[model samples]
Target: MNKQGTFVAVATSILAMAAAGSASAAESGKFQIKAFATKVAVDGAITKVKVDQLRLPAGADTRAKDAWVPTVAAEYFFSPRVSVETICCVTQHDVRGSGPLNGAALVDNAEVIPATVTVKYHFPLSSGVKPYVGAGPAYFMVFGEKVGASARALGATKVGLSSELGAALQAGVDIPLPGKAVGLSIDVKRYFVDTTAQFRAGDRVVLETKHKLDPWVASAGVAWRF
Candidate 1:
């Protein structure tokens, strides 16, 4: 056999053995966690109406909002093969315009809260790290008051129901902690959330805003077994 072909065969055999041998270290049953996060998105003008409709004055041609929020989640591992993860996060949008409003630039603010649940399948890697993937739904509640408006802008305070569906891909290194009773793990996750709204300002249809957020989360936390 060629040297490269022989090497590949031996490497494959080693990987299979490692996966089988590592099962003893992964016997822990249930899993849960709490983590904090900050997230943001790139605002795009998907339609001209959505763009032209944005209230801006002279000197500016485009607009964007920077948003951030804190979050927490818990997951239940039914088996080494399966688990469910749920998260609660809240985000607020800050709208900026290049114009004068009462001698300063016009700005507006709004907020939303999203809760998600997913079921995952875990796969063992050669490095003793477990990589997982999952997908499911999220429920969102959008609300808040308008900033810098003369009249109360209730466009954002209305509540709406949405079905957010996406996939989650993550990797974590599980480190042995004292007494083997606990483990320290660091995981990174990418979640996709999308939704739209029915909102109004005064007597006019302020907007039917749609939000698409794909948040990258870095979690360094502990896992306990019972």
Candidate 2:
């Protein structure tokens, strides 16, 4: 009923609002959504050659080849301390020149689709920047080829298949932006998997090889908190 009473009511309302906001900030914190892209140098362990479904041949070069691939991933935070992420990407490798034999030549090139489900844990740190690390497993399916001008090419044959029991390691940092709800992040990851390919003629295995595919992934993106 008086000016002093009116001023007290306004102050009380403001204080109540501030208290509610602080309580929300302390409850579950907030969840963040992040999306990013990365570059990886994929390498393999070995390449084996077989002849007429019988004789096995080994190449002098054992070093896995390297390829640069572009990848994208996304993550969702259930709370400030934990989150889940899923990744999907493709990879390409070059053709290594090899000995020739029959008219059949194995052409060289490979592509794969790999996906993973991972759990992330964030450590308590200073208010400005947050850093985290994660580990998980994945599944990879790929199609590959080895080519030669001649089918008789000794080990030019290539096949494609799927592999399981994949592993991944990743690290990233979150930097606060102007808005309390937005931030930027830089992240990197590595994936390890395997594949099997074979050269066959009329149901006979001609040239068979195993590949060890290791991919290094990197990316940068913006994150929003809600």
Candidate 3:
């Protein structure tokens, strides 16, 4: 399905699940922790050029490589159906040239920590399945950004990515285990964020560009409630 269609389907499924389970109360869990295998899919496309002293090629664009990482989440339940959650992990990516600058590496080995907090509403089902949707704020901290080999060949000395604040939309489901304290969880989150990339040659800034780093984070894992 197309992107819009996929999103629509997801929304419909969440609503349907909520409706189907509306008659049941959520499981008793004041605290929950999850350990996840996560994937970070990024769109590092350059959105605007603020400075271009190095004379970039026409139609120059960029893309960030996707990464797989381990993540953990901690959540506190205010009520059976309402909870607050935060996740922790660091994802690494490399930015490469696209369009006119295809095949050229622009940024290397950048690490980003996406600190997020969300308030989630869980829909309980008769079969003990809980589906949820959440929205919240996120702060993206970018660090350890290095200029790529290609950029260095062009006299670039240093590279930096600015940290930015953004928001996230989340959807997920949890299936209770026989013990009720442990469960299986699957989750998906979309982060709406951006960053400014600056390349420096000696003491002078050679290039500055705005990039959209909207990433889709997907995870599946084991969850424990206490």
Q: Pick the candidate with the highest TM-score.
A: 3
Model 3 residue 82 CA deviation (Å) reads: 0.5
**Each model's Cα RMSD:** 9.6, 16.0, 4.5
Ranking of models by lDDT:
3, 2, 1
Which regions in candidate 3 have their CA more than 4 angstroms from the true location?
1-29
TM for candidate 2 is 0.67
Ranking by TM-score: 3, 2, 1
The C-alpha local distance difference test score for the whole of candidate 2 amounts to 0.58
Q: What's the CA error at residue 210 for candidate 3, in Å?
A: 0.2
- Residue by residue across 1-226, what tens digits does model 3's lDDT show? 8544554555566445444444454554589999999999999998999999989988989999999999999998766677789999999999999998997988999999999997777877999999989777799999999999999999999999999998777999999998667899999999888999999988899999999999999999999988
Separately for all candidates shown, the number of backbone clashes (residues 3 or more apart, or on different chains) is 0, 22, 0
lDDT per residue for candidate 1 within 129-199, as digits (tens), equals 56665555555454563443422242333323234554444445555455667666666655554554333
Better of 1 and 2 by TM-score: 2
lDDT of 1: 0.50
Q: Between prediction 2 and prediction 3, which has the larger TM-score?
A: 3
Clashing pairs in 3: none
